[model samples]
Target: MRVDRKIKASYEHAIDNLDKKEENEQLSEDEFLERANLRSDLQDLLKMEEINWKQKSRVKELQEGQSNTKYFHRVANMRNWHNSLSCLAIDGQVVRDGNVIREHISKFYAELYKENVLLRPKLNGLLQYDSLDHSQRDLIEWDFDEEEVIKALRALDGDKSPGPDGFPMLVYKCFWHIFKVDAMAVI
Candidate 1:
């Protein structure tokens, strides 16, 4: 990656100033040592900043290419192959037709989800729950404020799976101030 113009300019300016300081003959030993230490610290900070920038750039590149990468395609293809329904056994006979398999799956789910009184046990009065008070009801129905939103965002695990927008909670948490208004509007 190319060096940032501002960083490069600042680094060059610091080096130039250090060189000018070093050329001065009126400086004492303590002042000279202090200047040398300051120069070293500045160089270290600049190097660390460069490394930080590189890491951020690399992470951005990986995120942007995630859906298009060869590795992603390979993994997706493997998962599909593993989960594909190529054959089904019914009545001790193997069925290989795709349409038949689809129909069978559809019918299976339809029956599975179909409501059947015989399959469900009645739970009337089996469990009781306290009703919410007026204050509790009001709180539940209240609009989310910025502080609430920020608290919720902070409560999420940063390293968990990305949301629908393909960004992890860490991004939102880190940039809450910048995105607060937009996020609140969406909410």
Candidate 2:
């Protein structure tokens, strides 16, 4: 609610002075028109943020299920996929441990999102999911050795610097546990 009010106030200020010509009377009509459109664009952005904030209540409900069982199921699926990929890499000759293959999937996700946004058009444009040729192709399918993978996970849980690039790796460890205990299937 506070954010919404703040956003509304900002919009009112922008609308009150859409035409800069009021202060600098020498300004042309074209510049004034462009500034007016910018205010509209920012208003739309604020509206979207407010809607997303409210929608979060539903998301939280879905995530906070009957118990932590749902969370475990989510984790298990991820470990299964990651473990399978590790095994594939070992068996396949085409793919090795490429430089970008982070134990934490978040890093790659950020890269993909950043690249996708950079390649796409400006606001109101459709998002394009493009393949990133920047990193070398990885034919690896992931079959991380069971024991080693488990041990590595335990180590990662206690890792000193699992942070992304620089920031602390808080959520990374949480996911690691989710993958190790909840995601991994029993033999």
Q: Which candidate comes out best when scored by TM-score?
A: 1
Worst 10 residues of 1 by lDDT: 70-79
Q: On a 0 to 1 TM-score scale, where does candidate 1 land against the true structure?
A: 0.37
Model 1, residue 50: C-alpha shift (Å): 54
State how far residue 169 of model 2 sits from its true place (Å): 72
Model 1 lDDT on a 0 to 1 scale: 0.76
Q: Model 2 segments beyond 4 Å from truth?
A: 1-21, 61-187
TM-score of every prediction relative to native: 0.37, 0.23
lDDT of candidate 1 at residue 30, scale 0 to 100: 77
Compute the lDDT of residue 77 as modeled in candidate 2. Answer: 56
Index of the highest-lDDT prediction? 1
Residue 124 of model 1 has an lDDT of 91
